[model samples]
Target: DPTQRGGVILLSVISPEKYYQTSPLTLEACRACLRGIAQLHAAAWENTDLLQKATQQLSKASFHLTVRNPKELATCVESWKGFLQAFEPHMKQAGLWDKPSIHAMGERIAKLAQYISDQMTPSLVEQNDTTTTPQFSPYATLIHGDFKAMNAFLPKKYESACSSSDDNQH
Candidate 1:
């Protein structure tokens, strides 16, 4: 069902080949994905206020979904650390990334998140006195917040057949 929040439920027919074997990924597919993501990010960058509103809604949803102590920021950080620790082993096994480099990048992200926590929030009493400059940039456009291999779909047989026909003339 399409919602007022702006999303649609899409349906597609999956081939049996897609179920039994991992499809060979091509460079062209990767490039197309990158292009799509770039376009998404560009759109988000253009709509900073809307993005911020969505972020706030997500943050509230997170609070309702978890039982972590709101007073202890380290608790939240530790949960994230645990997730990375668990995910890294499977990520390595899947040959998705180099283990040590993945660990290093995870650490870097944690450091940045810690820095944001340490600097951004202050006492509620002082909140009204505080003002923040919007952090949107022309570089920050619409981002596909959830991107994965499963989202990709190949063109139909007829489409590929036409492409091959054109290639024979070259």
Candidate 2:
């Protein structure tokens, strides 16, 4: 029948309009955003079954993913090293490295690289492994990979809806 379709149809919505910030975010606004992010993280982490299912789905999707592993840490270190190697020559050409402050900053970057390398110990990697339920080595949880101020939103209607739902739950 026309009223009872068996197949599902998906609809996509797009808007050409952009939202502009009228003013800089206040301290209270920043705090509120942080609170919202914490809430989101807690909710996702608490759901173990969902976490496992999502992990499985991601694996099946063949996505290269790592959570608090030595390899991931190494990748970060490599990224920093690559950045330094690629930019240091340019900085020197620009006479930036000649400055005492800039030279000190370069030394700091080198120290940071050493620190990152030191953190990749076997004991630490074993401790961070998700298989073991340690007290607090690495509380790996679903994270918003691209969380930023630009992506945050707080519509009154959504807040009211969430509040009402929470009240119902209580």
Candidate 3:
């Protein structure tokens, strides 16, 4: 329906070229899938239709368990120590693990926590340095926030179909 505001609808896949969740087990396949996702990001960046209709409710860039939430961030910080205690040996066996790397991971959690804290209450955050915050393109873009193996599907080849996925977010 052209009169409808939604852009996407349930797509019926054909017999020969059915959409499947090719869950990118190999490095090259993962790269290809990620490249496909990147294209979607670029295409949807600051699309006028999205901006006009859903800007107010959907301005937040990321929709995750921890993003923009102070308590979840703090919980992550506490969990980090326990995670290290449980998985340090396994991580060491995987190699490339070191004290500095461990510290850096903790530092990232702290920075994100501080960022959320500052955003929520700037008066108390004396070291409210915005530089450490993750940066994105100035233009706001809609993303496949739930892009994963279960949620994303691909045709036999990317050439035959669009590299888009339905997240059912809204």
In model 1, the runs with Cα more than 4 Å from the true position are 1-24, 48-103, 113-142, 154-170
TM-score of each: 0.38, 0.36, 0.45
Question: If both were scored by TM-score, which would come out higher, candidate 1 or candidate 3?
Answer: 3
* Overall local distance difference test of candidate 2: 0.44
- Rank the candidate models, highest lDDT first: 3, 2, 1
Ordered list by TM-score, greatest first: 3, 1, 2
When summed lDDT is taken over every stretch of 10 residues in candidate 2, the lowest stretch is 59-68
Model 2 residue 85 distance off true place after TM-score fit, in angstroms: 21
Best by TM-score: 3
Superposed Cα deviation of residue 80, candidate 2 (Å): 11
* lDDT of candidate 3 at residue 86, scale 0 to 100: 76
Flag regions of model 2 displaced more than 4 Å.
1-24, 58-138, 156-170
lDDT of 2 by residue, 43-153 (tens): 645455555544444322111122233454446646655655676765676676567675455446545644442332111224556677432213434445445655666
What is the Cα-based TM-score of model 2?
A: 0.36
